[model samples]
Target: MASAVRDRTAGTTILDALETYLAAPKPRDPGDPSREEFLDLVHATPALRDHFMRMQRNWETTLAHAIAEESGLPDDDLQARALARFALDIGALAQESPDPAHALRTLFARLRNGWTDFPHPGP
Candidate 1:
């Protein structure tokens, strides 16, 4: 009862923070204290970590659905594509990518075109 409410509230708070970060035109640095503090708090509490993991999976699943619907990709490929997209976004954000928007656009184009390996001439 009370515990469930508390956990729900915590999940909501974290979700809101994450959404704000993702929606921002320009997010704060990856090393920001708030990000570190929240990560530390989660690390210090196993129950909280469980909630966070659930939220993360939910978020990823949502992304996967969108990708599948938009690309008409096979069900077997949805998870891999979702993970690749997730890694690209997180790496770009955490590294404070110079021209992140442009980089993302370029990479997305390659993804759509199946550029899985860099092209080069044989020796």
Candidate 2:
């Protein structure tokens, strides 16, 4: 049914795809894809790349703030807990995602709408 397909493919948000893309390991077998193939995988997915860039920028900004708050190293280290927060955010976004591809597009749309005063690059 429509609902089932939506449920199966719908939970792939920008952040989810970004993390998956980032954490993907290099192919090990000879039959596996080459480095260029892997790069193409990410490049071909423009929506995913946009999401990754946005998330990376946000994290960098957030981590910078955290660092500024701390006299020493920030508490927001790249630990499981931090990643879990990101995953949860992604899941929430995914729940509203119409499909895997639409997820990032929708996110960008929302972000752009709220930033009328500030200019942002087109996704």
TM-score for each model = 0.46, 0.27
| Per-prediction backbone clash count | 0, 0
Error of 1 at 25 (Å): 3.8
C-alpha lDDT of all candidate models, in order: 0.52, 0.48
Give the 10-residue window scoring lowest on summed lDDT in candidate 2: 1-10
Query: For residues 11-117, could you state the per-residue lDDT of candidate 1 as single tens digits?
Result: 45322333334434756676767655787899799999999888766655555544444346664475645553554356346435566555555554554566658
Cα deviation at 4, candidate 1, in Å, is 31
- C-alpha lDDT of candidate 1 relative to the true structure: 0.52
Deviation in angstroms for 79 in model 1?
A: 5.0
- In model 1, the runs with Cα more than 4 Å from the true position are 1-23, 26-33, 74-76, 79-81, 88-123
| Model 2: residue 101 alpha-carbon error in angstroms | 35
